[model samples]
Target: MSDGANLRGRFITFEGGEGVGKSTQIRLLESRLRAAGLDVVVTREPGGSQRAETIREYILGGGARALGPMAEALLFSAARIDHIDSLIRPALQAGKWVLCDRFADSTRAYQGANGKLGDDVMQALEQVTLAGVRPDLTLVLDMPPAIGLQRAASRRAAGAPADRFESEGLGFHARLRKAFHQIANAEPRRCVIVNADRTAPEVGADIFRIVDERLGDAAPAPAITR
Candidate 1:
């Protein structure tokens, strides 16, 4: 059901660890796309619209303690269902560019990598949960786990609670970083690794360049069919 369709719009996903600047990059890309007069829909995974946002608080907040790995994965899948139905799929059908912060890749990293669940389990869950949905291009911002954690802590100092994942020790985050790297290595065509240690503007420029390359020298196809 989520097979690539003749999409007039491009689906670009920003993926990364806790503090790798996924939010900043997504905003940068959305702004750039809009500046060019492209129809753009900016959204995020685990939470996007009203209902999904509620689920996000539960999953990311202290409530995660009540949910086991399977439960947690299911909750994410549920949120994604709402996200795609309410946001992603509709925007793609209308030929509006969709810039998403995080997607199924997070599941693989957090649940598959950090959760100690094998790739097979994660892949299977994705198949069933997502109905074969996949991003056209995924920009993964990569950085050291230590640095990312520090950045996350700093950002959350007064914003909100650190949550279960954020509260996790450095070793857990290291595994997450490794998991993201493995995804990039395995899916080179769809996943690009952007070093996030650079200045924000520079990182933004890299993202823009990557999208341009993906869109190619010619105009994008009127319809994108998988």
Candidate 2:
């Protein structure tokens, strides 16, 4: 296809503490983008590419629970490297909008905020892993930690297990939530704070509005239905 056939892809990521509904909103946004007849690629991290997915399984399974924050950061960085090379970059280069459920912001929040890893270390990891491939927009779904934890708990099936991050104490989750807002405040231009402690449709609508405003002509035609 000619260059005129597709616009340069937009890299958009959704970030927040656990159960803020990044997955659901990504799906909604993907549907809306598809409805508008755009090529949208939906993915997530610390998985997306094969290696990353394997890393995700280990990390989220709590198998890596004993590892220190710095160690965990290194693992995530390694996964991100594969994900970028194998999936994210190629999709973007092909002029497909990439909507990610979580990105680097997740690392900064989950590990740097509550864990031993510091901001300097996290930033360095990002520099190495991202290789300058930053998201065009990041929508942070914000809500109370307690509420989010409850929601996350309710999602589990009977006898199911909680992930390492999800099993963190209330204090840790609270700190994680604060870190995300800090990130948004630090980068107001690239990040939008969405109140996610509401109904699915309400939160989704707010997200779509922010996306529409930032993306302008590039966003889907007509406003998002939900």
Candidate 3:
């Protein structure tokens, strides 16, 4: 591996409120990149590793009941630290292209918007927890909160019951959507907005085009299809 190979590693994050289909787009993008022969790693925050997954269960299962806002923020950061150390950093050091479903932005959105924790707290948390880990590019799946909530409701009805956050009302979800848009507006250089109201395949193609242009024509490496 030469300098180019070492520099090939990229951290790309997909961001959105619940039901914006970040997971679906991540899968589609990973598949496309793999077909093109690039070493791609797909992972998510709050549950990228066993330990983090445990924390994720706690958070989503409403186990964070006793935790105050600051404590809750710390818990999320703790999971993120473990996720970065155990998964994200290793994959990137191996020269793999990483696709993350959600990342620090979600914290700023949920904690800041809903918790009303303030941006300074979120920024400081990012500094200490992530140690300056920032995505090379962030694709924001933009959609109205009402539509997103409907999608989530339909999916939940078809699948398992709604999680704690999923049980939040439309107003809460609307705040989350606003937070995501605010984040993109605040950091245009690193974020690109994709209208997710379109069909899945169309949205997937938009994501692939952005990634393809950035990663160039290199073929992606093999991945264990899920």
The whole-model lDDT of each prediction reads 0.81, 0.85, 0.82
The ten-residue window of minimal lDDT in model 3 covers: 217-226
Q: Estimate each model's TM-score.
A: 0.91, 0.92, 0.89
Task: Supply the global lDDT for candidate 2.
Answer: 0.85
- CA RMSD, predictions in order: 3.5, 3.6, 4.4
Write one digit per residue (lDDT tens) for candidate 3, span 130-184.
7756788899998998888789888775667788777888898888888888999
| Cα displacement (Å) at residue 69, model 2 | 0.2
Best-to-worst order by lDDT is 2, 3, 1
Candidate 1, 1-226: lDDT as tens digits: 4564554567888888888998888887777766666777888878988889998988888586566776778788889888887788778878778888899999888887787778788877887766645688999998888888888888775767788788888888888888999999999999999999888999988887888887633224332211
Candidate 1 residue runs with Cα over 4 Å from true position: 1-3, 157-159, 216-226
Off by over 4 Å in 3: 1-8, 157-159, 215-226
C-alpha root-mean-square deviation, candidate 2: 3.6
Distance (Å) between predicted and true CA of 114, model 3?
Answer: 2.0
